[model samples]
Target: MRIAAATAIAIAIGLAVSLSSVVHANEEKLDYDHQEKWQSALDRAQSPIDIVTAQTVRAEDNEPLGLQLWHTQAPIEKAEDNGHAVQVNTHATEAMIRGRHFTLAQFHFHAESEHTLDAKHYPLEGHFVFKAQDGRLAVIGVMYQVGDGNPAAQAVIDDLEAKDGKLPQPSIDIASLLPNQRDYYHYLGSLTTPPLTENVEWYVLPTPVTMSEKQMTTFLSHYPHNNRKIQPLNGRAVVHHQG
Candidate 1:
């Protein structure tokens, strides 16, 4: 009886270890610590930090964050693998964020998401990178949840399916990609990628847009893991705004 009890305990321990390995294997495919060697990545305000809702504070003046994203005639120039995330370039998409005008430079997707709400990671995340004449950048983040098929998402995904990279037909509406509700979390954070530049404004829309399983699979196939790991908050003040 004693020998049988010991053998059972050993089997259970081995099973747990095997399950743990499987979960980790399926989570990410990138070298997560690739930024550890970069000095910029070690700075005070790195991006893709988990937004702790309970800890975030409202601004002193409590002014609302006004965003003006407009439809444009500029065609989507191209969509490419970019050896990082699936990126789409736009020519004339314009944005008037908080009374300042900026042009939509390009947008990209991150598999498994870079930013997380509380501690939950979404299936996908989209970064709409806008640039001002002064070279200042303001990125609007949209999280993608698994549900109905998103037409805007499909536009890019369809191109990816046809070719490994570079869109054969460049046509997409930047406005259609965003969710109905415009509420977002405003914070001062750096770029998630290399060179990890600081002082960029990140407006992360908390509400997630829907994407079908097949669509998710198609995007993931091109780049399985492109998201950077969540960096520490480091005493930075994060604020949330209503639409």
Candidate 2:
């Protein structure tokens, strides 16, 4: 009887230690500022850097970035507030980049911008995430300045304005989210959020889309500060696409 009691206490202690380790692992991933726990977040090629246009080198090849994105008027699958920000998941196949064939996975917004221009922060930023056939991830970021009301963005915001958790059959215009200008800044970087995986490609549009003050206020109501702070460049070169 004494031996069995001792073994049972040892097993309980071991299980407690294992559970603590599992909880710590999850905490590291969920907390964006906990870089000490995650080495990848502290890597050299981390993303959302301050982009100084003058310092960027123009691509010598002068080849146009073959960006092809298409989206019909079909209703989006779902839009949900995932505690971080409002994200819309779509099944639309009209969006692809560089002819590599990517599906539109989901898009989310950030307040006060993520990537800054010459250390200047904008009112808002939108990230359109795409996944390739080979499992590579690419994000197209569009900055927003307070100006005329944005109809495309309003479509999504309207749904969130009414509810918080989830919105079924929300109408979002994927194509209209882009600005008229195609000029962009390209670089190799990691995801802004944790696990902070490296080797992700980033394309940032110089021209910003417009959103009114009222629209901005609505978004802020949900996520007043949802952006991750910018990371260091670590000697990475930024390629500016002139075409």
Candidate 3:
């Protein structure tokens, strides 16, 4: 009788333990699913696109373009690997166009080209993000490839080494880096990043800057091929300025 009682007791304990483990596993799965759904909701619900008109880029006459560097007082938060080659931040900033002022929110880099011309891919691309006072959006895209020495590219590389991922904040002069001619390839598209909002007004510079082979290699090392596949034009108009 005692033997049978002990046998039953052992079986009961085993069942109890098994039940507890199953419950724990289910709880963990629930938590993970909740997180995934929450992230998806945030992406779908947010506004990712901004409007751009002639006034967006053209500042008031005689007024210098408002651009400032965001000097880092502390370490900045960078985006995850996500296959992106360049590490960057979205801290707030301000700049002047014509006479009005606009705020710079963030900046990031893309690799192996996203925008193609005549089916040509540039080696590198940089995006400077800005927001106008009336809530208009402006983005300046600078394309780069293998060739001559570039001062601006050198400055960014230097910053990456000196700061060692701990970026300093300072106002960047947007106008100085901009090409003398305002000619560009304009189109309406969405943010290339996830939750990929299709609201971005793209202004691809007509003239691409040059970079040395070493410079291009340096960036590629970190993000060898981080670029989203190109999206369709969706019948949107693309304006090209030859001048």
TM-scores of the candidates in the order shown? 0.81, 0.79, 0.58
| TM-score of structure candidate 3 | 0.58
Task: Choose the strongest candidate by lDDT.
Answer: 1
Candidate lDDT values, in order: 0.71, 0.68, 0.48
Error of 3 at 31 (Å): 23
Residue 120 displacement in candidate 3 (angstroms): 0.9
Residue-level lDDT of model 3, residues 1-243, one tens digit each, is 122232223222222222112111122212211232422212321221222233123322433333233332223343323233454444454554323455655555677666666557777776766555444454667677788865555555655665456544323333434455655655545455543443344567757777789878877776656555554443344544434
**Which lDDT tens digits does candidate 1 get at residues 171-203?**
786776788898777777777765566666788
Which portions of model 1 show Cα errors greater than 4 Å? Answer: 1-33, 59-65, 72-74, 163-169
lDDT of 2 by residue, 1-243 (tens): 122232223222222222112112223214544545545533777779999999887765734344677664546755557666666666574554544677766777888799999999987888877666555566788998888987767878766555554653367777677787877887777666655666666789889988889888888787777677888888777877765
The alpha-carbon lDDT assigned to residue 201 of candidate 2 equals: 66
Which run of 10 residues does model 2 get worst, by summed lDDT?
16-25
Best by TM-score: 1
Give candidate 2 misplaced runs (Cα > 4 Å).
1-42, 62-64, 72-74, 162-169
